[model samples]
Target chain A: MSQYIPRKLTRLPADYCFPAEGDVAAYLFSEEAVIAVEVALVTQRPLLVAGPPGCGKSRLAETVAAVLQWNFLHQTITSRSRVEQLTVDVDHLRRLNDAQRAARPEARTKARALERDEEYYNPGIFWWAFNPTSASRRGLPANVGRPRVAARCGGVVRRPDNQPQHTVLLIDEIDKAEPDLPNDLLEPLDRRSFGLPDGRTLTADPAQELLTIITTNRERELPQAFLRRCVSLLLREPERDGLIAIARVHEPKVAPELIERIADRMVELRQQRVDSGQRSPGTSEFLDAVRTCHDLAISVDSEKWQQVERATLLKPMVAQDEPSRRP
Target chain B: MSPAGGRRGEIHLGELISALAGLDCDDAAQAATIAACLGFGLRAPDLAATGAATPAIYDHNRALPPPAARRSAIPHPPGLALPASSPAVEALPAQIVPSQLASVGVLPSTDSSAAPAWLVAGYQRLASERSSPPRQTLFPERAARGVLTAALARWRPGDAGADLDLDALVRCIVRRRLPQCLPRLPSMTLDNGCQLLLDYSESMVPWWEDLRELARQVSGVLGAERTSIFDFAASPAGARRWRADREAIETWQPEPGRPILVATDFGIRGEPPCDLRGSGWPAFVDRCAARDCPLLILIPWSRFFWPKNLGLHPQLVHWHPATSAALLRRQRGLGHRTAR
Candidate 1:
């Protein structure tokens, strides 16, 4: 209630573990990231995150959600993603089916049920995100029989308690979406509300708390107008020491020397990738290399280590095409 | 998406300034400080403002410029069920047509050695999310983009001047060196970045809108971060842009290896001082040449109105509206005789 007790944090703690979410590894929010989150909360704007893939952009949202212990909802935007799908969609097919079925005499009792609009309503992420209680029941007020919660896709993160309220939302990989998608999000984000199909507006509760985190991989350029409205964050990939620290968190049992060596190797690979105009190795690749070496007992100096590096770090298109250089 | 949900289209930043003065900083420290200041001043507004002040919340249904219902296009062919995910791109072949496969000469292939060109191009179109639009510029848009990217006709690389050096690859193998990893072979890129200089002086009044549009188009081509913009009146030596890339009103100078695009008419309207022959204009071209920055001057006035006796220098193109690609090609020395 009332923006859910504004969480004004000075520094974002490193190596933060999510209680409700599973095995997210680490989210090392820098000082700027900390301020960005705070600014989003204060300004009531979406945090637009641009970064290399696997740079922990989504995790920032999840971590913030877990910290706030608010209801977490996420949508991974793809080429197929639509601005409408985030807010609400009517189950027209089901409604049509119900309409067809109402013609039968045996189904007379259920025929009148068609009059109930809730039967054909399906809430999108924004609905469940802003106010779950009404979204779960298709905008019907409470105390109506048990609310028919639509089966959620993978978007739902940690569920809230007996009282589920709106909070943090993660709109991941927005760049994968068409340019218009960001432009379309201007109002829903700005107003903290969107329009419903039934002509009713779904405004955030005066008490509702919401934090929107939108990530982009620079796959497509976002419109200038869209970028102007957001609290933008550019998350650069971590440095060598940062990578080593991340590796330790993801795989602690791996020997420090092995981690250091793999981290060093990843750094070298990244430089080559950048120079070659290829996608550079990210934290995810570094952790995978460290894990592979630790699991297989492949020493960095061992000839087999080259195979490991090729598999994890140097595995983009050009390198992938090369006949295995394994001796 | 609600069809009649809320007001739509672009919302200017000035109107939302109090809401959008967020950090545009690349430096983390600077961003943090900016955010802290915003947070501190967060409560200052409510405490200082009166009840007569307009509320920040943009209520859709009520007044405060009653949010106009956004007009949505009706899915046509009446009963045809189109997928909601249909992106805002042009009509394209949803599946690979065999007819497209044999058009070898028309459709050139990708530079990737891994696969055939047509297959890669088809696969890429199917995979990538995109939208489109372009304006008549000094450069030409391709039947498929990538055919003509350089702004000039006879182009020279300003920053990026490399192609895949197979020799470097061969040297690594010939030397029997399997050192850490494979040697890098950078693909050719046209430029390091694009820096645009605008003429905001009185002479440019008629073309002020054109100047702004040019900046947007260039930013649309090279990313906003890679594109820097400065506005000047009499000369570019004092042209100024926000210095966030490396702080405020920074002076214009040649960014080594970065191409410079200046949209100006030399303030030639009723003026002798602003002519291209003498004003700091020729000196500016020298600076760009010295820094290896290919300078392209886009003069709104056609070639006839262009000042006479101007010494030879940076390429100047007539920035005429609706200047066809064919004409631009001929001017750029890519005429029919040189075809192939």
Candidate 2:
């Protein structure tokens, strides 16, 4: 009997929202990361993230969406980021649906439109996550009822509960945004609803909390009021073990001996400080070394290490250092 | 050629000559056809504005990379549970110990006005309140950060004696200023508006520094603090001395209560497009708007005098010869030249 009931074999074509579950926690470096995700989910608050660049801050939002299987909304901030241009105009989608619904001939089919409401108007990533219709896991019915049956049954089956259970909102590299931008999230972060001047209140669906996350490279400092809302987690340069783990994730076929050998040397060099103590290498620097070694097909031992160092690490740094050496 | 004469020496036929010159003059009878074409066609209004002398270009200063995380000698001691909203930055006392404050020559009774001001008064006002230093310094590492920020902001193109006029014109369009002083096109018409494209790029490096210093001074005057001059006389390994205004770079966090002055440039050429839909400028604008940042993007310059992408975003303001001249004039200490 259970088998007789039609079941969805495939996920309806919804937006892919999160990154894989294991990756987010690893990248984010906090338990509160998920809880903050939950808070963003429940309260519909915009997530604010801060950290140095190359820390995988932007990737966390995508991981959340992939884990949850919801729509992923992404916006990357830059020095030129401005107000009134943040969200994509989802109004066009609403208008398209409206026109489609309007063209229906039957009064009862038209009545279905009135019943569902304009939850579709929410646009952008926020709209995808917060709009109830967007969050509805159920796809549109496969077959339309006959006109006589539609008249009797009112053309559409209206679900009493249409709220989304999950949504991921990703604001990437928020620090790159103009200075005023990060603090501006206070209201949206707190209320989970932004009031459109058009007299309509757009809200994240209550059942599915709006999971918002922001990332920054610390190019500029964000306002404290904006920073205080979330649990602050710093993603330091990954240690030797972490770099090994990252290399394994990217190149599973690479031998463990090779991975361990590469990680050990990279870690040792990174730990070395100049007399002034300023020669620290970042996770990015380490990763570049790994890629360089792989491209050169160099073995893990010291003989080929110089080639990796020359190609990936030393040249760029020396080139950068050359001009500043001027008297 | 007369500096002020219309094209071909027929001042009255300026529009006709401009029309013939501009490739985008679609309509033969349109009044602004020549102007629009010349505006888009002339590569560097600033360079054109300057008759001969070019300003030097300098490489923009790079910010120091983020420091690695380490265990603090004294961790953020567990007892301090910060409230949802901390006290206003000014109302909050310096968390530094009394000895440290004394060592720094800060008196416990220092007035609120004792805080240092920005390099520019307008910039000071535009800086979010959080960026303003409190009477007491809370973070010990702030001094280094302050110096780092100032140095980074001071980075500009090299002073290669490139003509500032073209650079200035390019910078103007890249900055995207409009309504105040619109961009000019070189139409044949007597009023083609190309004359307004005076070159000032040669003076840009000094102009930029003067402006930054002026801003620092203006903010300093209001706060009763004297601006300290930083010197660059050190040898490669010699001890470099930096004078940081604890009030400026250290305290300047972007705040809602204050306007943000975001400096952006189109570069000598535009940056690589971010996404498929020409996300370069539009993406930047949208993201800032979405995050609620009151962004003021400053297109400091363009590699070419004229760029095809100049008119895309409306909020942009291109730095005009008049504007650069005005800014230079205001900073007279730099001995900036006036428009002839």
Candidate 3:
């Protein structure tokens, strides 16, 4: 009577993110992007998204989670971020603090609670994504009841009416961390399971297939072994019509003529940037231009348009033809 | 050699074949148009009757450089944009037979006509893969894990601080002694980014792509800003790198304590390459050693095939696929911390 597969994206939705807390961004997926995402899901491998900054590589993960009605969690990688921090981190400082206080005779109950390693174990993004129910209990045995809702951690997720079945874990700008971090991460990723400081190995639920999306700014080359495990995808810059559609979606009230003019100007500015071998203005800048035009009433032919262009599109450097000092 | 085993087509025919089922054979013009954009030379006996010219591969992604900018002598890369409009705009009614059309992974019709008409972009050019050269080094990804980075990141010993020293914190907590400043308990950092000297001389024509890949690998482990990439003509004594702030090629002055990585052939290229005897490479090595800068020269030759005259001061690594992080660590004497 019915032929439908659950949690499969057939077409790009008009607005990928929905009516949730701070989920208002629009995402228009290209066919190639859809294929890459599908391949990753099918292969059970993490999707390594590579693209210029502001190309919505990060947004794609959030959108995918929303479309599938899956719980979404993300971790931002930085220079200081380590492999241990991604899966699970033992709060040594908190443990020490508690230890100092619990050493006193007055805090006998607190000292007993501190004895359990589960109290100090903080679940990382992977842990939360793999099994939120388990992570909520802080690596305690299944006999332990689910912790209070207050124990539920931070991350943007649109609550589904039904019980959540899957999670989309996004590790953003993976290349930002030291080269060792990624290689160290491969084991946990491949196993779909990780170890806790309390001598516990928590594996992903067999029924729930966790989708991990890893986005890199491509600041450096990720190692071969690490990359080999990933289903790769590259997001290209939006074309002329795509930009106009994106502008209309971002700023619906703006005049169509104004949106067209802003889009064209953005294209020209991007062309100039490409010619100079610099990063071109992306969709975010285009949206900013559209919003600025609507708010300031700056027409393309008007003198104020150049100022808007300089402020939103061209970035720091002035175009060579603009002035003498630029030379 | 037989055609099936030795030769490969410009476009994989199997991909085109599977695409025929989705097409409307009645609209022969549309099918032919698709075929043309796909770089297919459909010389059907019936198609030729329509006087339609065969479409060559339209590489509008600008894969080649401009004729005037071409530097044939130095083997300069011809930039990534595909070259010239080779796709025939004329459609063929005769070649529209479904029997003729058979290829796999055809271009999805969702692509606007305005997009590059090729089957796929260079990043996804698995359909038209170029035969690799004799010596192919990893480009997109280098090393297994962070071997290369581990070897080079060592000598450039980073600042006095790293991430929070968990061991120190645990010790302090057990000893019941707290430091004045919490942040002072950071660990000793590994990684002092290196200066990369890339040789773009005519002698390095064969390994130009490898050199580019080398830069990407080094920059990957060490942040691009930390890995100062400079273009060297031959010797690193007076190399030049484009300063983004200045928008000009400025002399590369190596910083002290920062490890130096030179991807050069010691200015000698032959069947059995001559050693770095008379070249200024010896002087360059000596100069780097004096600056307390650990030097690693990545030669695109086989192991033990480089000049032995320069002494053991500069760590020489064969820039080949066989080279791994473990090998790099052993070569650089960073084996003490090697996970292998």
Candidate 4:
């Protein structure tokens, strides 16, 4: 029988309405960012996003997952994060305890092999994503799905049912890990499969390609080999229109005139900082200022608004001091 | 298995056993027993005796006997089970530690903040010697060598000198004989051992390749073997070695005697100015002072906007393209005199 697959993937509308909950839903994607995401989906390649901190690099994956109704899994990369943590983590200690119990004649009742078998292996997100039946049976409260096992071996082993669903894995701040980490991911990423301790190869179904989104702050340069495999986009600081869209998404109730005024001021401030060789404020700061204005009920043209701007926008040291008085 | 075999081998075997145990190996108990029998030359009966003995025996035989006593017969081999106490195992020497081996540059001294009293005194002396106003001398080459030695020597501990505007003297001499100073570039020759560290941070991206080429050229001019090259970033821990080549540079700790040349844009973005109080500047300054190593900074930027007070050390030298050729010649002249 021929399997049914959707011909065309859903494209997000220019003014798509996001859900009331979650930061990612409220994110506004620029045209370039949208193109990058679309290219990644078509090619079944990971999207490598390079940008400054707080520039929506991490949220892009969440936004994609939400819009496409795919299972979303996120892992923050740290200096101590091991590659194995991303795939499957077997609890050797529990297995050892079970083994010790099995050796005792008096503990036979508690020494069942089932206690130490698959239960000892806490499946990582990739494991659940690859085996949809396992994911459905596990009954992730957040995900929308029902268990319909296609194949089963004993109570512990199962494969996905006929329904095809995708998974979006967000590897955030990948540059935080060791220098060789990106290179280490080459094999798993290229083949879309990784080896398990139990000799099973967890392969992503080719028909339902797993979507990977990698975000980096450029703290360290990623290996050229790894970068070549993924579609990349650099998210630059937004202009006035982009800023207004971002602010509006986060603060929907904000007056249009106030949003415009705040965006213009932010752009001017950023440009001023850059011209003076100072570190400019980013989108995060802009959002903070907008939120402050909204909560305090300050008008853009009011004297009280200037105080709020100084308190929120200017750094503590700068805010405390007055401009040099004439001699 | 003989107890008289290499102590190192036995220690490594013990470590392997402990590692396997930590991984909760299913056969860890059996592996540990076998390791004791073969590596420590303990018979099954001796293990039985130890297992039967009270906990007091474990405490009494805690420390492993010295390596020299490998040939001596002992009642127990102290390898019955992997020692739970960490101190019982011999600590690996710094030279052989895996982490130490992986790192390419000098591990900063533990006491980074406290510069030795002698080092401070030595710097004062060298600073004083070079502080003398450059007298109009007939022998500019001799004066240049004297300045170079003073600068290099002050980098070592137990030295003292006053501040001297040595840059002014170099400029004065170079400007006086402009035509004569413009000599053809010197051929490649071995220098007094020096390491060239380049800045390869994000801000340096545009100039990274060019700087690396310059470093390669500098390496060729100085004997390749004598000149070690490294790249560093303005990470939290001052600068760390950046590896670009397959062959790792030999691990070396900067010492008082060695000359360390750094080529950087000095435009470290995302970092406060080096002169700012409570910034990372003190940590950097202390690191250099702790080693008492001479530094020659090569900056590509214009002098009009250069950062000031890089460090208070007398041995520190800043050079730009406009003045580096003259400085290089002066350095080479010092080398020639030392050789003669």
Candidate with more favorable, higher lDDT: 1 or 2: 1
Clash number for each model: 3, 92, 20, 17
In order, candidate lDDTs are 0.61, 0.39, 0.64, 0.53
Cα error, residue A248 of model 4, in Å, equals 2.3
Candidate 1 versus truth, CA RMSD in Å, comes to 29.0
* TM-score attained by chain A of model 2: 0.63
Per-residue CA lDDT of model 1 for B113-181, tens digit only, reads 777788767663443555545554433322111212235322333312122234654675469653343
lDDT of 2 by residue, A1-327 (tens): 011110110221222112134433323223324433433333233455544345566666665566555556666765444333342222333433454456667634555543332323223444444553532311122252222111111111112344344555667776554335555555455555554434565555455545567765543445545554443334446667777876666565677777787788776665543222233555666667776667667876668788777665545454334111221
Consecutive 10-residue window with the lowest summed lDDT within model 2 chain A: A1-10
lDDT tens digits, residue span B124-214, model 2: 3544555655332111222322222221121111331211234444575467532232222211100000000011233234234433432
How does chain B of model 4 score on TM-score?
A: 0.37
List clashing residue pairs in candidate 1. Answer: A2-A207, B243-B247, B244-B247
Candidate order by TM-score, decreasing, is 3, 1, 4, 2
Global lDDT of model 2:
0.39
Stretches > 4 Å off in candidate 4: A1-11, A14-24, A100-105, A114-118, A134-162, A300-327, B1-340
Residue-level lDDT tens digits of model 4 in A4-108: 121222446545434444435576766446545654564455778777667888877787777776767778987545566666665554554566567689888
For candidate 3, give the lDDT of residue A190.
75
* Best-matching candidate per TM-score: 3
True contacts kept of each: 0.04, 0.00, 0.10, 0.00
Over the full model, what C-alpha lDDT does candidate 3 score relative to the true structure?
A: 0.64
Q: Runs in model 1 with CA error above 4 Å?
A: A1-23, A142-166, A316-327, B1-340
Residue-level lDDT tens digits of model 1 in A5-108: 12364223433323234644445556556656766776666777767767888888877776665667788986446677888776654654566577678887
RMSD to truth, every model: 29.0, 27.8, 17.7, 34.2
